[model samples]
Target: MNWSGWSIDRVLILFVSLAYLVIGIQVTMFHYRQNFTHKAMWIPVISSPIFLIAGLILTWYNAPWVHTMFMAFMWFGALAGLIGFYFHFRGVGIRVGGWAMRNFLIGPPVALPLMFSALSVLGLIAIYWKVR
Candidate 1:
């Protein structure tokens, strides 16, 4: 239950928080126009699976069933967010030559991450309590 003297629960907390932090950064970047295109959106979408896989591997190492289940829920929530972004981008792509397409791209980059981060935070807290 310990890794380098840290409890598995603590590691889970750290990893989950780090994931949220990354998501927050992504949201902020999009909100500020640092990354404002369909191509840039893929950065987080591609990185998410890496986070999920790392979390799951750690969970398996620790054999925390509740934590694992919580992670599964978090993964599902993330997937939903990705799907929302996809649709949002799809909408923009359909109107690529139109004047308002730029405005449409802005919504998903910020909104989807915000929604997903809230859900993931709740899920992480639940898992942390369960494991503790």
Candidate 2:
């Protein structure tokens, strides 16, 4: 673990952190437009940045506690995304012409949450994987 204490994992984690920032802003804006009708809507808005900060912190500080906490949060985020997918999917089903293409397109995006989960998974991989 030389090269100024950076490796492929660190770089991937950094990328994921920045990505969280971008997705966080987008979710914030989207949720804000809805006035955050449900309390759960606040989950991603708050946790996303935490993920980003934790990840970014990891890029600089290679501490055991940091790694431990980051691992926990990534799992949390991954689960949140799955839960969100259910919510979003249900939301679409609630709309007119339920399960139709238009509802799928016009209702809450179902993919975003899954994407969120995927990103968390990627970070988890970067955290644990051995690049050889």
Candidate 3:
């Protein structure tokens, strides 16, 4: 690829979009193992594609509508991740060991949800930050 007029924010948005794709796959597999016991498990799986597509569209056109849609999804993803963190932490507490390190290690990934939120924040920064 020729390096020409790609701004840093544009590149960062695309990178975040790709990261969503990877994380989506991982989430899907993890949920599948649990048989997707609850519908909430599908939230991140579905939203991942929304963010990825909107972000990729922004990279191509970046129309005002696209920007708004992408920004909305980013915010949704951020909130969902936060909620997921709480749920995952509760899962560990409810497990056999009851909040022990072993339960945290084996019950649910307590930090993965925070990672999801961090990625969404990165995308938001890319979209909202004014490069000077």
Output the number of the TM-score-best candidate.
Answer: 3
Off by over 4 Å in 1: 1-4, 7-13, 18-63, 94-107, 110-132
Q: What do the candidate models score in CA lDDT, each in turn? A: 0.57, 0.92, 0.88
- Among all windows of ten consecutive residues in candidate 1, which has the lowest summed lDDT? 105-114
lDDT of 2 by residue, 51-78 (tens): 9999999989979999999999999999
TM-score per candidate, in order? 0.36, 0.94, 0.96
Q: Candidate 2 — which residues are off by over 4 angstroms?
A: 1-5
Q: What RMSD, rounded to one decimal, does every model reach?
A: 10.4, 2.2, 1.0
Alpha-carbon deviation at 44 in model 3, angstroms: 0.5
lDDT of 3 by residue, 1-132 (tens): 764788989998999999999888888888788888878889988888888888889988989998888888889889999999998899889888698998987887888888889989999999898967
Candidate 2 clashing pairs, residues 3+ apart or interchain: none
Ranking by TM-score: 3, 2, 1
Q: What tens digits encode model 1's per-residue C-alpha lDDT throughout 30-74?
A: 645635455645545555555555455555564667457557757
Mark the 10 consecutive residues where model 3 has the least summed lDDT: 1-10
The deviation in Å at residue 41 for candidate 1 is 17
